[model samples]
Target: MKHTIAEVKISYHPNRLKGAVKITSSEYAGKVIRENWNQGTLNLYEEFKILLMNNSNEVLGLAPLSRGGMTGTLVDMRILFATVIKSGATSIITVHNHPSGKLKPSQADINIYNKIKDAAKLLDINYLDNLIITEDGKFSFMDEGY
Candidate 1:
């Protein structure tokens, strides 16, 4: 017997980073990531976005991955890797908001980062940083030596 299954394909336009806005520090990435967020809806839900970058760490684009309830969001590894590969990203800085305005990363957040980092490594993609954002402030895993 033969089995049939759905197939997935990845594709994107030829747009590259403009202005060469290189990410110099965690603070820089934080600022850009926060700017992509919707301030009014920030406190209402948890959303995850990845800042796609080139080999020079310049901004390529930002892709919103998932939107979940006020507490947490689900990240599918397949979708995450697919986005990076599709966009031809050399590296990525992942970020998500904490609706409670808590800047600390939960255990789940850490786990997610590790998984993402490891997977990216195998694909020859750099996992630059993982950030937890809030209205008042932001947390950078790389700054914490994670």
Candidate 2:
């Protein structure tokens, strides 16, 4: 189901995200990320995949992995990887929202990240980043050195 900001209450908390995406000066990338953020309420759990050119960092595609509950999104790694592979994307970034507005990564979140990282490595695809977006903005685990 699609969610709007009016349908949910969001709580903003620090440490809500545990991973990061590399910042590029590309306006298109920024716009895509922001547009997706605006599409739903803060803290709504949803998974998105961003395809990036290995050489120029140009954004290739932005696709949703899943639409989840208020607080959690279930991502299928196979679907995520398949999309990236099919796009011939050498690198990709994964993003998800936390409905709680807390940016801290949960144990489950870390575990999932590790699994995705490994899968990407095996496929010779770079998992560029896993970002946590909230109403306030976005968080990057790689930026924070997580």
Q: Which candidate achieves the best lDDT against the true structure?
A: 1
lDDT of 1 by residue, 59-127 (tens): 888899999999999999999988899888899999999999989889999999999999998999988
In order of listing, the candidates' clash counts read 0, 14
On residues 1-146, what C-alpha lDDT tens digit does candidate 2 reach at each position?
97766655434232222333433733334456777565545555555555444444555656777877776778788888767766666877777777777878888778888988899899888676778776666677677676
lDDT of 2 at 14: 24
Worst 10 contiguous positions by lDDT, candidate 1: 9-18
| TM-score per candidate, chains pooled | 0.90, 0.72
Best by TM-score: 1
Model 1 clashing residue pairs (backbone): none
- C-alpha RMSD between model 1 and the true structure: 2.5
Candidate 2 matches the true fold with a TM-score of: 0.72
Model 1 stretches astray by more than 4 angstroms: 1-11
